[model samples]
Target: MSGHRKNSSDIHTPDLTSYPPSPSPSSYSSNSSSSKSSSSRNRVKGAARSVAGVFVSCFTPPEEDAHHNSSSAYGGSDAFTSSSDISGASDSTEGRRRGTARGIYATRNDSTHMKEPGSTIFTLAEIQTATKNFSPAFKVGQGGFGTVYKGQLQDGTLVAVKRAKKSMYDKNLGREFLSEVQALSKVEHLNLVKCYGYLQQGDERIIVVEYVANGTLREHLDCFNGNVLSLASRLDIAIDVAHAITYLHTYTDHPIIHRDIKSSNILLTEKLRAKVADFGFARLAADVESGQTHVSTQVKGTAGYLDPEYLKTYQLTEKSDVYSFGILLVELVTGRRPVESKRELDERVTARWAMKKFRDGQAITVLDPKLQESDANGPVLENILELALLCVNGSRKNRPTMRRCVEVLWNIRKEYKDLLA
Candidate 1:
């Protein structure tokens, strides 16, 4: 008899010749003999069929073969097989073979199943329809992330959809999305932007946030020609912004650093109330314990408001927020962009120039001319400017805590009211 040689394509077949057949009985009932022989033939044929079935089922494209056939002993060869080939006369043995084949099929299917991670997945068709096929009329603004569009949901809720650029979908983009969601979801203050939801499909990363119809503080400041906002109004906006920062730094469980604190990130309502927006680079201080914070990663922030210490060390903390907020305060008082004006090279950034004026006991020179229109209480500007100076101090340790800064602004607001009374 030939030695049983199993090939890779014969996984379910056993070498029937290897196992000796049971001895035939000298005499038996005709029905019993016929049934036994019939069962044995079926067992052998079924095993062979199963082997062929398994081989075909397991076959896959070469690229996927590494993943699908990891445990396969055949090693992609057509000539080798496993030890499944065998013949048996018992019905129980035949049943067990079928059960084994079924199990193998189930395992193969389970291994092949691919599940997607949790994210906002919008069909291209759906997004196209939602934005009216990317109509130009709906575009709100172009940003570093991508272009933003104002859209209306079926439920009549207004949404500002930020359609991120394809470049934003890099390897670490998923981490940025998770970071924004985790940080924004925790902060709930009147002066902080509200995140509606997010969507990520293919190369499109969409962030849907509340539509601040009034636009950014930067827009208001720039459009007003230094005459739009009175000193009192500016002071009010400053107080609210300070409160928002304080809430993030001290009130939240883990402090959040708003890495980008430019005027554009400071949104406004129709009533001129300020709300802080954008948290792409925000991180938890607790994560520093795990050596994850900063981690010598590439820097991320706006040009004008970035903390110099953070730029050097990449070690971001709540004090970095204080420094940015100080820059914002100077912008409020002087109505100057953080950068120097080309028309007057002598003028430094509002923060440095104001600090110099404060040191010289000549803060009025740093005050925005528009602020004088309301004859608003000068004492409030003095007190707030003092706090702003403390926040913008070059040494990180000298920056005031957001909580104390909030109290100082509040006290100044009260002082204004008392003086008016």
Candidate 2:
């Protein structure tokens, strides 16, 4: 919208990895089993190639794929079921089944898109050895789901492995995991986190993610005592995040509502760029007419940013994500936690307090105290404050879509460029 040339090195560029195109309603409802299976297989292969290529291109001295011919990965057991749910049938019996299913001609619908023979099954011990027996030093963070650790593979690839509690890996959880994979495989955006793969071994479950070094936006905003971001940088981050959400809600065929949108879930890269993470609470907006489409589930999401309409009706829509994104914009603008407020007389949430000040033309009072001494009056800051106000409007329908938000921010960025030049 600004007519400015975009950076070739920008993370959002297309050459990085092609995102799977979202499946249409017709594709989703395809009646032909063979056609659907073929489509699914094509999607899976495309995703795998893209991910593999990304790692190869970025990390120097690329390594070959671990040879699958050797049974060494699973301790010489040709048909060992690493999943705890599967029983230990003798290798003689299981090996025959695997061999019969080996040839591409004999393929049928399998739970994992990959043919049985080509599947690389890593033993629990292999992971344990790779992770140094899950030592405390490797621990990254703990959340309601589980603990994540930074692991370096024998091949020297860095990965973030999440170990989930047994209950969280139940059958229902697996379905959700598949859905999450479907959602992420088709989405490649700078502001969205990248998921590598998932593994299930007996009772243990692991989610391997691309390791991002900068940590979460919450940590950067609230925890980092010194080195606060310049006003321009903060606005840039807000705009980037908004653009990502815009892509999710508007670009996808079935609009995705990021049910949980909070600073803690927004991870930062080494460059201090933001990427939305944690899709456990995300859901697709159900079609209005198809009663079967939008199944209602327990209301899930972070509290401070949850949508009131969704909370009231148990029905979520894209607007719900817009509402949450608005709250995030407010957080970026004020450097205040969603709920934090020090106002003595009126201990209202920062969103309300900031909006009040914004309307009164005294929004400067709500600026992060640390920014007071700096050049906070610049056009970038003014545009950011205005965007924050638009995001937090009382009515959800009044909020701008992510595309509109991106355009507005792009304009502001152009203004900033002109001012500087």
Candidate 3:
């Protein structure tokens, strides 16, 4: 989180264009008709602009029109990180606090308050009971954001409660907590994790989102529970992720950039469908009407799937997410992590090596060995790898728009199905 720590993958940061040498790395629920209504979008757009503005220290918080909401990240020799594969969050509290806007709009509402649509306001008491007083037994996941516990509400519905740490690491967890609540409150999509409610009372802050019963996409890729992911499943996952991002970029009230996009952030349902999770690090993009190309601001968190251009330039755009998505595409097909120090020196960065093999007319060699290459699957893998190369292109301008990503992925999935048929 301080100075840039160089690694084998670091070599690709300057440029990740197809010529080679560079690298890197949402959901919503809104009603169909109301969301399409021009009047509603105009109303949300005003608030969306404020959220995109910088929240620098000593900078006054903007007035609330009352709405709206709001990556690299690494560690490892085998791309070393914690057991959760979530590290590199250590930082000068002041630097992170520079973007803190805790005084922004609150989503909290007591039982007496009228319930709002799209999102809810939960009470601490209710959350405490839901989590059995934050029982360690209920723990499901943990990261820089905090611990996530599986909670069951009184209504017999299950939820994942992400409680901010009340310790030293939480100096400004409120900002992240609120940032997520704001962003999740705005959009809904099948591939996007839904926001159930939130709590931000006193030092206790939390976000309750849709609980995907199955584990993460990373876990599934690792063959968790002795289950192997097939190319068909992988293709669907790639498409699901693309559609989720497309919704954020083109269909949301505003284009919200998922600054942090990685396999670990992708949760799978019992059906193996992907649901993009974690919006604590999301940045609300300036509406397409603004004509502003990039968000000039602080360096946010990312994972091995980080965008080299965003890292080098400190100017973020939706294309940055596309860069990360490209990294993910490589991960999906190869069953390799972004960094794997255990491999040969040249092979440490999976995206680079995989693309190298593809360019050398050995694209089939890049397939995850778990799914042995076959005649029918070989062409599908090459097309996806080719798309991945385009996505990781060093220049953000060269990366396809998320909508375009969906289009390309849809075609890949279609072709694969045709081959199987």
Q: Pick the candidate with the highest lDDT.
A: 3
Point out the higher-scoring one by TM-score: 1 or 2: 2
After the best TM-score superposition of candidate 2, give how far the Cα of residue 389 lies from its true spot, in angstroms.
2.9
Descending-lDDT candidate ranking: 3, 1, 2
Give one digit per residue, the lDDT tens place, for model 1 in 1-421. 0011112232221221122233232211133354554564354344333332322322221111111101211112221111232222111111111111111011111111111111123455655666776689999888655688887755555667778677632434444554565565454456877665566565666766667888888877776434387666778888878878766654444456776777889888888899898776666543433434232334466655666665555555666677788778888888888776563544645566676676577777777765563334456666667766666655454455565565566666776778777
Model 3 lDDT per residue over 111-201, tens place: 2222331245689999999999999999998988789999988876788999878753433455566567667766556788867777766
Clashing pairs in 2: 83-202, 84-202
Question: What TM-scores do the predictions have?
Answer: 0.66, 0.67, 0.76
State the lDDT of candidate 2 residue by residue for 1-421, as single tens digits.
0001112121221121122332333432324465555664565556644533433322223212222111111112111111111011111111111111112112232223233211233456756775798899999999766788898666665767777766742444443444444455544455676555656655676666656778788887875745777667777777768767765665443456677778888888877787787765566665533433233544566656766555544545565676677778778867888775455534346666666676566767777776754343544555565665555443344454555566667767777677766
Sorting all predicted structures by TM-score, with the top scorer first, yields 3, 2, 1
lDDT of each: 0.56, 0.55, 0.66
Indicate the residue-level lDDT of 6 in model 2. 16
- Which stretches of candidate 2 lie above 4 Å from their native place? 1-126, 168-179, 223-225, 288-296, 341-347, 373-379
The prediction achieving the highest TM-score against the true structure is 3
RMSD after CA superposition, every candidate: 28.9, 18.6, 11.2
Model 2 TM-score is 0.67
